[model samples]
Target: RKGGAEMTQREFKDMPSRIARLPRDKRGFPIPKFVGAVDKKGEPDFRLVSHDHMAACVRRNLCWICGDVMGTRKAFALGPMCCINRVSSEPPSHYECAVFAAKACPFLSNPNAKRRQRDLPEAGEVAGIMIERNPGVTAIWVTRFYSLMQVSNGVLFFVGEPEGLEFYARGRAATRAEIKASIASGIPHLEEVAKRDGRGAMSELKRMRKRFDALLADRVPA
Candidate 1:
């Protein structure tokens, strides 16, 4: 949220109301919002991305991360690095987001993460997921992107996508040991969240860990 810009009053007032009114799926997941607006803290709170604005974004095939109309069709889908029976229904983002997310997002920055193909099935296969027809070249971050979804029980589902792979050279890569150490250090924080939240939260955290582990297992020894 650090690099987010300021928002206008009209956006501040309208987006939240729009999100509240959007229809929910059978599983109670609201449609994914096109996050163009943010709170005073520059965070994409639940109140962002108005209905009309999302419609316009879909109409123009805008970048989900930057909210700009894509200048080119060469965009990427940011999802989980480890496949693990997961699927991404999120819209395409700018190639720049792929680079930014790889460096800035925690899961994506992991060394074990690699690009892979994702099959976006027809809509009815999943309750709330939607796929883009004639989607841009399937690009992904070797690392992935994360999204927050509010479900029926008022719990947040942390979704990840690691498809449509793309990488940019910001600097030298971390050694495998360094990456492993970093992941090890993050475990306690996840455990704390699981303990504080409950079994459901713990289950989600474990699922994420499983995906990470799968990636690590597939890593060829250097």
Candidate 2:
């Protein structure tokens, strides 16, 4: 609609609708393939349309999982399910240094949690229980950028291609050391809200971390 913009009204409206509903990058309508990913002076790769076409089309946010910043043009169809599982956990979240509280504490019952028992015998169950209670958790798609492992301290962490992270908050996955570096790097400032303690932060933190470690099938590397 705007000048210099190439997206027609039909194309513009379709982008948001796709992003809001789709979660995986491999599935979606108007199914966009690698028409040819362009690495322009300032744009990310994976271009679907001409620059003018994209400029005209409003850009959509990326799925929390894949880190794919492109709009719905490359969105997947599963809606959070596929994307989250692709990484070490299901449901996306970014926080380290918080509390965790959840229902059932699956860490106490699951067998898959055994491998992670060195630090948490019930990690798997904890993740399952959390997923059971909070079905709307946001899982990250970081398997592409990090190495998941457990530590001798029994603490789980992820070593990303660029940074390691520790999930001091909720959700599942090996808390990567790179994530901790990111947090220390003022990531919290970029966050919309300041970290605060509430009725459930601790349990949720514990459960989510365990869930994350269980999903990775490895403990945070020491």
TM-score of each: 0.38, 0.20
lDDT by residue (1-222, candidate 2, tens digit) is 468765432122213333333232221222222222323343323223232222222233333322234421222211122222222222122211011111111221121232222222232231111222212222222222332344432221232321222232223432455333433343222221213655365455446445544643443453
lDDT of 1: 0.42
TM-score of 1: 0.38
- Residues 82-157, candidate 1: write the lDDT tens digits: 1222433444455655444444332344444433223312211322332222111122433234443444422222
Highest lDDT: which candidate?
Answer: 1
lDDT score of residue 121 within candidate 1:
21
